[model samples]
Target chain A: MNQISDLITAFLEQCERTPKHIAFSQDDRQISYQQFEQRTKKVAGYLTGSNQCIAIAMDRGIDAAIAIYGILRSGNSYLPLDINNPANRLNFIIADAHPVYIIGIGPCPENINIDSQETQWLDLRDLLISDFSYRNVQIKTDAIAAILYTSGSTGTPKGVALSHKAITNFATWAGTTFNISQSDHIASLAPFHFDLSIFDLFTSLSCGAIVSFIPNRLTLSPSKLTQWLCDNKITTWYTVPSLLSFIALKGSLETRPLSDLKQILFAGEVFPTPQLIKLTTLLPNVNLYNLYGPTETNVCCYWPVITKQLQADKNIPIGIPACNAVLTIDKTTHELLVESDNNFSGYWQNGKLNTVTFKPQGYATGDKVSINAKHEYCYHGRLDRMLKCSGYRVEPAEIESIINQLEGIETSVVIGLKDITSGQRPAAAVVIKKGHTLTHIIKPLRQKLPAYMFPCKFTELSAIPLLSNGKVDYLSIEKKLTH
Target chain B: MKPKIREFIFQELIFVANPDQFSDDDDLLEAGLDSMGIMRLIMFIEDNFGVTLPDEEIDPDNVQTLNALEKWILRHKK
Candidate 1:
């Protein structure tokens, strides 16, 4: 099959063989493959051949799953909107996308008014209940599948348009690389809107693995999450490093028996070594992996945690490219370049292909990496986030990783602020553990880190500001530092 | 209830801020309670009271003062 949607039909045929097998689990609800297929067919029937851009404003549930596949079956690219986003941001995206229909699985926003463009509003439950037959339709591999919006460096959100081939390549490669099986139960930690969820959903579906979704309320609650993991017997989980750090610090993993968890994949940001160490200590059996990719490429490279020696090195290498993906580091700039089958078509609204100053041909990676003696790639933060201090160009991630090693410093952000005499001075915004002295911590941080890399200014924060996608909000920190 | 609220605020502020210097009426934002600090306070409030804070109620002013924060909590409690 050339297209990803055809693979879904294969999955459906497999479901017929194992109809009693559990397909999805959310909170207290569990849906079998048969029920899920029937519901998906109903949704597909209701939304056949709709050319209008359809926005799926549903929470993480069975209905949301149906809505996503339904839109794809109808030959329309689905836009997953985080209902928790600010009205202004949502309006900007909605206006920019100019969707013809908005599907709400739960409650639709009443405040923000849309333009008079014949927007069809449908409750997902009602749509799923409607009479419709599952018609096998042909979808081209190059056809646009989804448009995911991410915050740009300039504050505006840019939608990345992904094709069926890109998504299928990623899912197939990920399934093979991870050795995902029909018996595996993958936990969906990332929101449907985030690129992380694309692998969580599609990869699992392709392998006939059960996809379990954690409730939004218990997402950050470590204790609750621990219990959820144990209760569901979750085999695999995919999320950002920030959430993993939070869970590790809060002692969530220690509370429950996480022996069933086979794999833990972390992406979006750098996974701190200390947190990785703690995770290895708690659940040594679980295979820990660091997935590296921007939204442009779903996942280009991954470094599977092989041994403690790799973890102790402080620079956990984002391993070689997966199947159908090739990675090369620019010799001049040392920037990581990825030429992959999983690369997105282009940005949605502006119709610009790789305008972020990094894309060359099919390669669009913005990260600067250095190949080790072993030939494994070690990440050195974003090129734009790096700063030159005291004649030495310093990556903030280098100092930030060291800062996090300090006792009682829960979270740390290293930023470069403009100095009148020194050109640029590195400043750190830190969130210390309870009852820890900020001054005392910074003193030792100076000893551990170099003179130029030591934070010139130390600001004590209770928590690190998080973006909507759960990554650290560096823009907000920079704004605070400048002010 | 107000005394309890004050005590909770004092405890949380100490964990995150300079406890000895902060008074009940002290401006948290001005006294180094940044966005991250505000989020910690929100988490503490949610965990302690067993209440979920909606995204709409996470305004700067609602978390600025001890009295305002207390009022906000009480309003949500009802």
Candidate 2:
């Protein structure tokens, strides 16, 4: 238990200490630490030694939670595939990672094609009922614990692998810094794949706090979402800014009360300035923190926002480094460089990218940051064309490739536009072949992409403007739209 | 109002293609409209139909289908 380098040991210690305490909760169901331990052990028995990489494809429920713990318990890395994503994208991930085991609901989702010989699917119903005792496996500190794939610009998904050492360091740092305790009830709002969930899941477990899930069904009705938080007595809440903004705008929080909330942590995308100000006015007693980190380095810096900080004309500063991370700006490009044990090992099967991402010392975070007068890092934007829409990292080049592959599409380019509610939205501009209308391109694109990735708007272009370098002249297109 | 609702589903919401194929009782969530999409639908309803949907009226069972959506709209519509 004193060995914090191994996350599983630290988590198991909490289970031993508080066996009857609630570990995780969904709508009407709650699982205690003892039950969680037993269930995770059962899942581990089915998956151990079968694959180095175990993929979790279940919905957001108790089964998915057990699968995650079991994968870690089995000493294998877990890859969480979003159940709502397009089958094409899911198939792409399966083909790329080639995970040996896929744990999910029985009967694979329609249109998803997997290599049957290589991949084994384990139904959650069967896994839960298996009569197997907990297996104690030797998990090395350097062994990969989780693999998170982000959108790649070149039409492929790049996986970022985090070792047990990295996540444990982060979880321990979060637990100590946030002062998480058994009395606190933490809300798990972020999806399993997002790095934000790491702090909610591990930090809470490290301290024996109950982790509550914000059900997807309740999210649409902001009032209900607010009600759930108050009803559950969530002391600590973590989610992306867009969801917070949605509640502020749509949820009648002004009339309702949330006396139990102590801390609110937001990250994954830039929070709109006006929404932050509005939120501060409503919840003057709550402590708000703006977290900043890419998937490569999980939450390296954070800003504890005060009322005055929200009113500042400038962007919020992503405060100094946490958990022994050395953050510095590149001299020429001003790109952020992070030297930390918390940084991921490297991208999966991407040796060329490893050379670029994992430099001689640390990971080269492509994000650019500037030091504010308060001596904290202020986010400018990404150095690349990557965009964040609804907290999902998007690549315009990826969408453009998909569009260009469609029949009757001559050329295509996608752009991100700043939106008031969702932070940013993707918009596509396409030049069509003869005998084609804009409507012709919509159906195929919708089928291939998820809802968030779908273009908010589409424009028809006679010809795609280009620079002398033969690259698409994106600046001119942006200017034209503005004019 | 029903026709306008149908048009909005077809035009604004891209998830439903060939609106004629959709039944009145189809579960919208199962049809691929996520939580964000549902919020966007609420905004569209408020803007176009001139109705302010209160918190209680935003229940999942109430807006699960086109028939339910139309009934909900009729109840709230100005």
Candidate 3:
């Protein structure tokens, strides 16, 4: 329990120390540390390490929470595939990662072309807790604990695999930095797939703190979400900047007295200064921390927003390094290079580790950052065409490729439009093929892409404007869409 | 009013393959209208319909479907 490299051991130690303490609570259901330990052990018995990886398609509740730890306890990594995502994307990930065990509500995704003989599907209903021996599976050295898939430029999602050492290091740092205690009640808002979930799940539970699940249904209603937070007396909360902004805008913070909320941590995308100012104004006493990192390096830098000095004129810097992260800016590209203990082992592709992510110097973060007057890092956007839509990292190249593949599309350029709600929404400018109208492209595009990636605005351009060097003119397209 | 609601939702808030085929009782939340989309829907309602939806009233029961949304807006519009 003394900040060991093994996350499961730390969690187990905490469970022993505080067996009666509330571990996970959702809606009316609450699981104590002792109950969760018994449940996790029981669930682990079902997992035979025949396949080293498993895909959990369960809803974001008590079952999904138990399944993740159980899988890890069985010496296997897990991918918590968001069931809300388009089936096309989910099937792609299932087929790509090839999880031999699929623990979910029903049958594995019909589209996955896995060897039926090798695969096993365990229904949540069937896994009843009774008399079962605890499986003390020996975890291999440098074994991956979780695999998170992010939008890739190659028109497919890339899985960033993290080892137990890396996540434990992160959990220890987060627990120490935030002063998480047995008394603290933390809110789990971010979905399992996101990197933010690491702190929400591992950091809170491992530190003997109660982690409250924000109901999936309540996520869409900010006012109700605000009420839920106050009612729950959640001391710690972590999620994307957009959701925080949504709550501030419509949550009616004026009416709700969230006296227990001591800290708010936001990451995954930029927090607009205006909305940020509004949040600070609403919650004057609560501490605000802007956590910054790519999936490659989990939370390398962070900035604690100082309330009085928060000027609308100046943008909030990503701030100094955290979790023993060393940072440097490339002289030529000004790209932020991160070498951190929390850095992922590598991308998981075709059942092999893709270690090509690290450059000669360090992990070349696609993001370009510049140091502010206070020597804090200020974001300068992506070095590539990657865009953030509502904290979801989106690649224009990927969307363009999807669009190009559709029938009656000559070529398309996808651009991110500045949006107050989502930070940016993808917009497309396309030159349709002969005998094709813009209407023809809408249905198929929606079917293939998730709602976040769908183009909010589509333009039927005769010919896309070009630079002298033959690149598609992005500035021209953005202007046309806005006007 | 329902037509205006449909137009605004389909035009900016969400994507329905056939807006015409989508019934008034259809679940907008299931249709991928998230928190941000709901925020925009409120703004659209206030701007176009001149009805200010109180923050406390922004619950799933009121905004789950087109008919429910229209009823909530009309009740507030009065």
Candidate 4:
């Protein structure tokens, strides 16, 4: 069995043999195999023998890619911090990771500086220009390759440690399943921090296909996105349902028939049946796939969206497990349990592997599911405090923690309220710190949380309902919101 | 002015807003044309008109009525 290092070596060899082939594209800039490999080596050289985590606080572009590959080559895990992250959150993450090095395309925060120990700060453009040769270094399969931090249920971000073997396994499976090859051109739509982007980056690299990073501004504009897709002749598109719905609802598909687009894979949320029907009508030749998984499990199950079949039965099953991924259901609870090569080793910081939830046999996913007569598994809902409302996963604890951060909030509880129009909306019931208006508290909360995570309804309470154990009574809050 | 454009706008407004009642000049933001809904409308205009609308042109006033959208489309027509 070839290890991840072997995969990288093979890819590098292919690049050397065909140095003219385009490896990455961003805006007007394109990087060939020769240039990519040479720059990757410089990054590796700079990071080699570094026994500390490296934080990449750079914009989403070519430099970010090089830094990631460099961290991998240097035998240390890379942590990606969004350039637009709140200063306090960024500080918290930097403090938690305790990164010995920081790479930035622009200026670092003026207020907070990493002065402790030896913290080297390097400009990405300077590093890319430096000439360096590739070094021969062996990498262990189980070694941590990257630590992806996701918004946790407790409001604090948790780092998911991924191994080289796990990433390689996912890449191999994705490349083969999607029929990725040298002829393919895939769009890199998701942000670097988002785990879904890994599929776009590594899968394209493994197959020797072109990976183009779409700018964030273009992604927000429906018209620009449509033009870019058509102009670039993007063959494969991997994005969230939100963007896909934007296209469908905006009617961009009608004018610009994505004729060149052969595959459209959507994950990170439930694809609405109405929008799915519209997409099929617009692009009849394109194959649509609904991928299902959490950040922890990189695409364990997939359901091919056959427009005619899915239209007949409103509910779409998440489908069967991918190659090398095993799925089982807890007979009593019906909670989905997943065992896969792509499963993260464990969360960082706490250093406690969740062996109770995840045994050597498999990890018990908190999502509830049901198997149909055809033996296909369908996602029902989560059994935990997490809620999937309008395609974005909202952790109540995370929202509560943010609410608690406000000065005038004594305590708070966040819960999901199902509505007829929008599938579910987040509602917050707060106990204020005496003489504070709900409006005053809500204004600040909106600025702090993302648009999707914002509470649509605010209910003021004297005190947050608590259970016998003194924990916030989520069920009582839900009932209050529902009523 | 084409009635197809007006009909499309009205139909989309109904689909997105799902209001108990609404007037042609009703503010979209007030009528529940949230960020997600606005995105959907933007796509609708592009597909139907074969013209890409910029983010600056996607305000509530520009999409509140058939007249507003038709005027905007006419100005930006390729």
Say which docking band candidate 2 falls in: acceptable
Model 2 global lDDT (CA atoms, 0 to 1): 0.80
DockQ for each model: 0.05, 0.29, 0.55, 0.10
Pairs that collide in candidate 4 are: A250-B43, A250-B44, A251-B43, A251-B44
What is the lDDT, from 0 to 100, of the residue A6 in candidate 1?
A: 40
Docking level for model 4: incorrect
Q: Which residue segments of model 4 deviate by more than 4 Å?
A: A1-7, A111-115, A130-134, A350-357, A389-392, A417-425, A450-452, A465-483, B1-37, B40-78
Error of 4 at A167 (Å): 0.7
lDDT of 2 by residue, A1-483 (tens): 365787789888999999999999998999999999988888887775822887889776677889998989888888989777788788888778878788887876665577657788888778889887766898899888888888888876778888899999999988887889999999987888878888877899989999998888777678888988999999999888888877777778888769999999999898877878888877888899988888988988888886776653556778888778998888899999888878888776521124234665477778999888788888899898898988989888878887788888998888877764656677777899999776755667766777777776677789989999998888877665434
What C-alpha lDDT do the candidate models reach, one value each? 0.70, 0.80, 0.84, 0.72
- Candidate 2's C-alpha runs over 4 A off are A1-3, A132-134, A350-357, A479-483, B1-51, B59-74
Worst 10 residues of 3 chain A by lDDT: A110-119
- Candidate 1 residue spans exceeding 4 A from truth: A1-7, A50-52, A132-134, A311-313, A350-361, A385-483, B1-78
Q: Across residues A1-483, which tens digit of lDDT does each residue of candidate 4 receive?
A: 254442355567568667888989998999987788778888887665643478798777788988887877777778887655555666667777777678987556663466556566777777766766556677777777677777688688788777777787888888888898888888887778877888886888777888888876564456567778888889998888767766765535677887788898888776767777777887899998988888777788998876767662375789889747899898888888889988887776632223225765587778899988878889887888787655556687887898899978898888877633234567888888877776666556544665556676667788888899998887888777655
Of all true interface contacts, what fraction is found in model 2? Answer: 0.21
Candidate 3's C-alpha runs over 4 A off are A106-116, A125-132, B1-11, B15-27
TM-score of each: 0.71, 0.91, 0.94, 0.83
lDDT of 1 by residue, A1-483 (tens): 334444455466657777888888887899987887777777777885643467888776777887887788776788888665556556777877777678885556773457645556678888877877667667777777788887544435668888777888888888888888888999996778888888777888778899988876554355566777888889999876655655664435665658799989987666657767877877878888888877787788888887656554475788777656778778888888788888887777732233333356456466789888877778886677766443234567767776787888897888877532222557778999998898667555533443445555667777899999998898888887655
iRMS values for every prediction? 11.7, 3.4, 2.2, 8.6
Error of 4 at A129 (Å): 4.0
Clashes (N, CA, C under 3 Å) per candidate: 0, 0, 0, 4
Would you list the rank order by TM-score, best first? 3, 2, 4, 1
